[model samples]
Target: MNLSICVLPMHEHLIKVAVVGHPSEGKSSVIATLAERDDIRISARSPETRECHSYDIQVGNQTLLELIDTPGFQRPREACAEFKLYEERIGTDNIAATFLAEHGQDPRFDAERKILTPLAEGAGLIYVVDASRPISKDDRHEVEILRLTGRPRLAVINAKADESTHMDAWYALLNSTFNLVRPFNAHRASFAERMDLLRALGQLEKSWQTDIDAIIAAFQVDWQARMDECAEAILDCIEAIVLLRVAKTCNADDRREKERVAQQVADSYREKCAKRERECHQAIRRAFKHQLFDPAPVTELQHGLLDEETWRLLGLNSRQLRRALMMTGAALGLTADVALAGVSLGVGTGTGAAAGYLMGRYAMQPLSMLRAHTRKDSWLSRSMRREIYLGPARNLQIVFVLLDRALGCAHLARNWTHARRDHESIMVTRPTAATKEWSQVDRDAISRYHVAILKGSSEQVYERRTAVRELLVKLLAS
Candidate 1:
């Protein structure tokens, strides 16, 4: 028997960042948001993180950054007092370890030891503080203790939903102890805010700059890829909905009976299209890495999608839709004016509009092909003379309806913070007004994409999807 082992090269260049602060100051929330992991512990009732825990930011096989979550400082004032005793005796670099040794058995300093051990070992600091509330003596003392460690540090002001009266006080206080101070609301900050924080993190230390830049670059690339995947998912779903067809042989010559049975098959076709659109939404959620069972969001969209409210709330109105179509048509050198009546359509009824109406596009002409084909039902004899084909989705408006739902869902996922743990939903509330007009570029890209998806091959579909993805990423940026 031969024994073989493979040793994976572990990179030592990964930056270690320790997030610390007083209890309930959002130390864990900062880690949860930065790591983008909803599974991490975040509590509203009390402090959650009781010991040191690590979360990694990895790209493919590489780990670019490691965030260490430590227990919040329980005795910051006393810890600082004890650590200061040796500033004149022992060197500044040794005061933290000296405090840990002397207070290891002291019950009050238990949390302090847990927080200081990471900093003593060379991790840069991210001191989280509540900027919404006025700074207390305890907050100041906590910053002083972290400062005594003499490590490169960044102070992060974690503003809760409504705590903003002390932003200036926090900035003025934190600037004295840390290299940089930034006010960030972990629960509601958008993608751009997070990126801005990362950029500031890179400036805390020169040696860690390379790793921080790598982290930022990898994050940006991953986000763009996710948007592209979402676009692809939407396109695939649209194709399935358009090409869906169900047929049965008809024996009776009565036109009424044929239409009735055709309606039943048509219902089945609609059911499948609905299911495909749902899967596409799921795919978009997965692309955004939101795996939590969030039925609230889905239910809200479903109610709106079923009642046809989301189309009115988030999608382009009739005028915008018509204008979009005209713009799309102009890009393709076709002069087509479309009039779309806004109505509350059933699941697969006259759905939403795309570039106004694409009803007569050569690639989208399903009526001629639908009526020309016939399939024999195995249950019926060959004497049947007719086959009724209900659809290949000639109405392009329904595609817009599904696209609206996808966009709505993606928007929620992009802004949602992993720090939240409840059934709280995103995009649940109706917007005060309908969405604004899309830029000519976004509208034109959407129009061109509509054409490619209708007639293009797989490669062409991918190319068009990529074009749309570029615009989506810009929208998601902040």
Candidate 2:
């Protein structure tokens, strides 16, 4: 047998950036946010990274960039003194290489050596500093050491505090030393801010401009794809709720037993709908690369999806609903015919116009008897017993409510950055009345989709569902 070996080609000119800073200055957090890597060990109690670790910013098969998380400088002043001594002996050409050569095995300069090792290997530098605190001599020393390395560097102000009073001083110091300085909130940086930082990185080296542009383009395309996925998940959740039905067989003559069965079906329906909604949110989280962080429902919106407050806050108001009904060709004066599985509901104008307002104002009765079908006893000669259906909800307000909640949750998940490690949940923004802002075109499209779902036409449902998805993608992008 012949032995065959193959070597995979490495990405030529892969941008390597070493993130260096003092302990607890958010070097790891910056990398986590920029790279969207949740596996990076980050803690508030103490510094988590004790050595240099390289993480690739991979887009599919290509590694566009590499972020090197390095240990914080333990003794920058001492390291700066060593640099001066080396510059005098080795003449400033390869200060990083010469210093690492001498201090590579030294126990006292272990962190310094690891932090500077990447610079020795020609990696660009990203020096992180907390702009919230006052500048010190040690910071100056650290900057001096990086400057002597002769590598293109960018200064990042990682302001962890709420009120940063010394931002001016930090910028003044960084401006004189680093090629470019940018303030990045690792825990709160949005996708746009991250992109801005990448553009700043491109400015560091003229040769790296094309590569940086390509990476940014890839990221933009990936973000749009994720948004599209999120839209599909949200629409799927709403569709499941719209098409949901739960039934129970109860003796039609026994009113008490019938009521009990109805209540059970309603509860079950609520839970199923809520579960679908949660699964949608989880899908959105995955789209944003939040595999480890499961955001809890902390706001008022988390109070059960069928809660009275939820309905009131999220569902369309009475006026909006009335207009939407009219737009869908619902006759105002005559007994209004709202489609419910070919079951025509004779809702009067007062009922139709006030439906949304009443639903929002009072508690929502999630399930109602669609119809009772009688079945004859085959084994024994017995009277007809009825099987009661509790759902495929008849109330049109639910469509708007589900739409609002799904859109609001998608917005929250979309904005939730990967760097946030806190247990606090993303607050569901209110008045989650998402449909109230819909253009006439949007409302008309949704109305058609609603009718298509109720009519149970596969072809019409597919066309209408596709239209809704396109609308949702635009909304999510906005």
Candidate 3:
């Protein structure tokens, strides 16, 4: 989402936090999760990062926070020994700056210098450790080094797996030296957990409290705006697919030609609907800040939209389908009654309701488009010209199916963390229909919206679209 609101003034200090740790301790993963950035490279291989990189959390033109991903400490014991000796010799508390002054250009201390550059420059520290592993002497040395830097520090125990057998040991050691310690799973951190981590940053320094709160607020607002745009995209996709129609001019003398055109129109309608749905899902992914990963492949998603499993899993049940159909048909009947000046004494309403019930019973059948019919192009033409029409879908099941699929996409986009790189594991599965849990009011709103689209009433469409969009925004928020 391109956040345009200038939440902070240009003169405000850009909060800088350095993510530092031992080699292969999930420092990069932590940064990736916190920055909401998947472009940051994360690997299980040792010494993957050889240099420092910066990621800025910005809204519009203003930078809110700057997270520096520094190279992991390769010689923490040696660095700690040197720092202790220097502090003893100089009788000073500013050991980090003094060490950098002496060894900033030394080749042997390249990694150490790079790691301490941000700390010496007054950046807050987020030290990551693999809590799933046993504590080592080097880990202690690393903790001592950060303690001597005198920067406000937050220790993050990034447990790579579900195993927390060594968590208590790590926490005990971290609590003595760090201002705050928290266990954050980089691979599976939720939106709320990420926010909690930000709040913890606010507590590290009293001077940083207001800035941290403002950054958190900006992030919340940015996320909500993304969801609102997603809601708009979903609504637009539904309208496009629901009102979709295809046509072709056919010859008057050729019956076989007309049949061929009808078949072509059907194919076109399916292809167009599938394509539009894919585009909408992609838009949702972008809104959630997904740039490198896709929940599923394009062909897989396109075929899955109308696949049998998707229909069975996501389409509305018999009872719900009946209610939706009856509601829509009753509205249509009311329109007809108004046209007839109420002369048909409630007959239209009864017939429409019965028809709706019958259609509902058959709604779960195989997907099919409305039968193609031909109409004269114009009466003034010299020769009779006919046009064949193919859609505005006949089966109401497609509406429910499409909605469920869009919701599933939004769900994955919002919840999929950037630290996850295993493509197969992140691939989209047939999601349970979230609409099954929606209340009657929600269902009624959808039905009315569908009716509005079908009737092609511009004013009714505007009102109903607003209602449905508001419903979707609430759902996505939850």
TM-score of each: 0.78, 0.87, 0.89
User: Better model by lDDT, 2 or 3?
Assistant: 3
Question: Which candidate has the top score in lDDT?
Answer: 3
- Candidate lDDT values, in order: 0.67, 0.74, 0.79
**Which pairs in model 3 have colliding backbones?**
none
**Top TM-score model:** 3
Candidate 1, overall lDDT? 0.67
lDDT of 1 by residue, 1-478 (tens): 0111122124557778899888888888787777778788888878888989988876556666788999888887878787777776786875678887887798888888888887777888899988878888888788778788898899998887585677777888888888999878888877778888988888998877776666676777777777778777867877777667776656556677776776666566656766887887788777766667343255244454323454445545555556665544444443222111111122233222432344323222222222323345444665655675644543444455556666666766777777766644443553323134566566656666666665567897778777776766665453
Clash pairs, candidate 2, are: none
Model with the higher lDDT, candidate 1 or 2 = 2
How much is the lDDT of residue 48 in candidate 1?
Answer: 85
Structural RMSD, model 1: 7.2
> Candidate 2 local accuracy as lDDT?
0.74
At residue 398, give the lDDT of candidate 1: 48
lDDT of 3 by residue, 1-478 (tens): 2245645554566778999999888888898888888888888766777899988876676676788998889788889999889878984466788989988788878999998988888899999998889999999999999999989999998888778789888989999999999989898898889989999999999877776777777878888898899999999998888778888988866889988887787677768888999889899998888887775463345456666666677768878887777777677663433222222334453455665575566556434333466777888876766888765664567778888888888888888888778767654455758786788898888888887888848999999999999999998999
Residue 27 error, candidate 2, Å: 1.0
- True-vs-predicted CA distance for residue 52, candidate 3, Å: 1.2
Q: Candidate 2 lDDT, tens digit per residue, 338-378? A: 32222334544444444433332221333222232233324
**On a 0 to 100 scale, what is the lDDT of residue 473 in model 2?**
90
